[model samples]
Target: MVKIARWNHDGGTQSGFVDNGNCYALPAGQGVQSLLDAGLDETLDLARKVTGSATPVPLADVHLLAPLVPATIRDFVAFEEHVEGVRKSIDGVAGVVPEWYEAPTFYFTNPHTVTGTGEVIGIPAGCEDLDFETEVAAVVGRVPGSDGRNLTADEAHRHIFGYTVLNDWSARDLQRREMKVSLGPCKGKDFANTLGPWIVTADEFEALHDAEGFLPISMSVEVNGEAIGQDLLSNMGWPFAELVAYASQDSVVRPGDVLGSGTCGSGCLAELWGRNGSKTPPPLKTGDVIRMTVEGIGTIENSVGERREAVTRVPARSRPRNRVAPVVTAGT
Candidate 1:
């Protein structure tokens, strides 16, 4: 398996394969995205050639960056246990909605907010209940001349380049308030989404898939150096292929696009709080660190930074008058 990464070394950014605790640099200006765009087979061939020809650098010497700046991000609530747990916590409900079973549901998140492992994530202003969601994400790869739309599950599976550990940081207070209007988790989620220690190419997991195409890989999370929860990827209601295909329905997905496997069962503090009917595992705070790991992929660890004060406030507006008045009958 080839583990791909981008890092800062010798005062500049370099992209390469990481193996045996060493980084083998690709040629100047060539990055993981470029290799992906070149097609998967070629990318694998290049990985071999580059690692063989380049001088190795100690992995600890450089600072790693997010594996790639995603072209788009679509995060899905693919785990049934997560949905049920969170629904119970936030709404005082005990079960998932039927619509969730009909299709894989996803929301587009801010790709611009993507950060690397080891980076500090800041709490948004006015957010008291900060949280972390442990997940696995698939990075899309391009096939030459492909439109990347309305794909079959098999086709979508083939288009996946690699997978990485993800931390979808949340502001629960803001999320609850905004979602009351039934429109958003926007401001609540836009702050940060952490990806990487590095990306593990998808081919590495070929032997791990079950008969149903679900991966049984173990996933776990930690906070402030204490183990929080663990679950298997097989618990997802929909497979990664189905989630990718659902994202492409009547739409387009480009290379570098990311599809997240939402929070795994017992993957977040919010879910645990709901299950226990109390805040057993409390919300994250400034200076708290979160570490998440997927079996085949490496671990991603990040510290929470201080929350910033809001510079401007948005005051509530008065309700608007109805544009159409009721009409009275002539007899009345």
Candidate 2:
């Protein structure tokens, strides 16, 4: 299988296809963006040519970046086992709602906060409980009817440009607190998400998936160096093509948008704790390296950087008795 990667080489980041354990770079300063901009047929043609003519750069010398900076990111919760496991962690919640069966549930995250494999990421301010989520993500390409029509699952499946591993890094303390308010996960999850090792072009791996388009790769996570857990990706209840199709409904999903497969069962510390009823492992600490690997997709190895200094809290002032709220003015 050919792997596409963008790396720090020849003075700046260059994108290319990897074959024979060597990188065939596009050009100085150009990256996957150029390929996507060139369109599908052209990109494939260029990839083929470069792999043969370009000077092969051994994988060791290249510093890989996030395969490409995604235009947007949609992370969906599609694993039933993960859902059940997490529910048990809650004070009293149990079982999936009827709505879950009808449609996929998802959330938008900060696309700009993406961190590539091997990069160092820092903990969010005020966060003490850090965690990692193991997931698989698909990079979107131009779908035939993306703008004017809602594409069916078959059409959406064609738009998948490739797949990559995703580490939806989290600050559990902040996550639980914000999610309680039902409006956030903003500050908690926005700090950083890890993606990479590289993107395996759709053609390379799609054949491995089953009739329903569920790829049968093994997903695993290692903290510091201990194997936390691993599971076959086939266990996910919803296939990624369905997730992409769901995202395209009533909305436009542009090329470079990343749609994730949520976390696999027992993919994170939270689910593990909830499942075993054992003590939750200590949160990630500075200098901790986490390697989350998905068979065929490659491993995303990242370390927790230093925590930022906490910002001082501003005290709240009571509202004036005569102050008019914005809603009152709008009524006029």
Candidate 3:
């Protein structure tokens, strides 16, 4: 298996692969970004050269960072069960929207907030009901394509670089408020989204495909050592390729972009608590540890840290005001 990753080395971060409990840097002069920039063929060739002959470093010696900073993050809600559970958790909400069945729906998240496994994530300020979402992500590669044309599922599928586990952390309270504004999720999700342990190249999962080419990997989640959620990647209504194809409709999917699978059914505390109503565990807080594992990719664990000091926003009077309404005038 070609498992790619980035780890702390020589006071800096470097990209490499893990093999037999050890780590080796990617062929000299190459880092995770470079590999992504190399596109598919060259990246694959370089990955193949990381053999047992290279000097190995104890995996224990390095702290892993997010495999790579995603150029863009397109998180999609592709699982019906997750939608149902979420609706039930919040008040007076119905099940999935009719549009959801027509095609995959996604939102772009703050790529700047991405982190890796083992990192300590602080709860976003003004957020109390912080939650963690468990899912998988496909890394978008820079496959040759002209702008303005959409790639079909078959064509887009080839643009997949690999897969990684995702913990799209959320501030439930903030998310509720923002989503209610008739817009999509923002600050509530912008703080942090964990990706890693490592990236398992797509070829490593070819054998795990089901009839529709959906990867049927078992996925599980645990918080503070307590098992909470388990499901299969196959539960997704729209597979990664379809989602990728839809996302690339007249848009560019650059290398290192992330296409998330959203949370699996029952894969998040909000869904469980919402579905069960008060019987589920409390929302995650400082010191809470969440561990999410995927059958082939690997596990990513993060500890919730104390909230940071709040930054004072510009006072209303001093801030720029909204556009002034047109002056009232006669019909003339």
Candidate 4:
């Protein structure tokens, strides 16, 4: 199976497939997103046809970019262990809410903020508790005439193009304050979300599926070269297919739509801090490097950049008056 990639080489961005430590360029201007829009089978066929004619470049020579900018991104909380850990950390409680078992839940994140491996992720202004979330994101493929909605698990599985490592960077201080109002994870999470190394086609994981439809692939995270935690993909409360299907319920999931498997068990510093009862490992600071690896897919590493000052700010809202309504006595 081929690993699809987008990179900068020769002062221009190009799309290609990487194999055996080399990258084979596809026809100029035909990017991973366009290939996926053309449909998965056709994309694979074209890659095979072009491989022989394409010149090989050493993988190290090219600068990688996010394989594709997503149509939209929906990140789900699918790991029970992660949920339990963070809940305890935040609320000083130990169990997941019962509602979580009834259905998989997710939130929309900023797609425009997506970055790739080796890039610098700037910590958002006013955010002192910067953190990284380790996740696996499924990239949707097109079915030519079909726009998927209300799909079954099996149908959703077919629309999946591939998987890649995702770093859903978080600004915990902002997230905490915003979430207290119960309307956000918004500004807290919108700053930077990283994807890539490359996209590994879904077919590559065919032989690894477990009876429960989970991949069982190993996943891990490290900070500043120190290994932090590891967990299996199979540990997810719901598999990728279910997450995709749930996302398509009454909504549309188009090609290039990304569905993230949230943070895996012990996948982020917040979860660990909650579990340990303190920030023993400490929050990420400027220049801290984060590296994440998924066994079958690949690894993505990014450095935290200096926080920048906000150019503008919104004024706080005024509190509403506690006005009482006058009662009308029979239309008086």
- Assess each prediction's global lDDT (C-alpha) against the native: 0.90, 0.81, 0.85, 0.90
Q: TM-score per candidate, in order?
A: 0.95, 0.91, 0.91, 0.94
Error of 3 at 325 (Å): 6.6
After best superposition, candidate 4 residue 62: deviation in angstroms? Answer: 0.5
What value of lDDT does candidate 1 attain over all alpha carbons? 0.90
Give Cα distance to truth, residue 44, candidate 1, Å.
Answer: 0.3
Clashes of 2: 0
Give me the displacement of residue 96 in model 3, in angstroms: 1.6
**Candidate 1 residues 1-332, lDDT tens each?**
79999999999999999988999999988898897787677888998998899999999999999998888899999999999999988888899999999998888899899999899998889888999999999999987767789999888888888899988888887888788889878998998999998889888987788987899999999999899989999999988988888888899888899999999999999999889999888888889999998998989999998988884248788877776878999999
Leading candidate by TM-score? 1
Candidate 4 residue-wise lDDT, 151-243, digit = tens: 999899889899999999998878877877878789989989999999998889978998878989999999999999899999999989999
Residues forming the 10-long window of minimal summed lDDT in candidate 1: 311-320
lDDT of 2 by residue, 43-111 (tens): 777888888899998988889899988888899888888877766664336677678778899889998
State which candidate has the highest lDDT.
Answer: 4
| Candidate 4 CA-lDDT value | 0.90
Native-referenced Cα lDDT, model 3: 0.85
Which regions of candidate 2 fall more than 4 Å away from where they truly are? Answer: 28-30, 90-92, 143-149, 312-316, 320-332
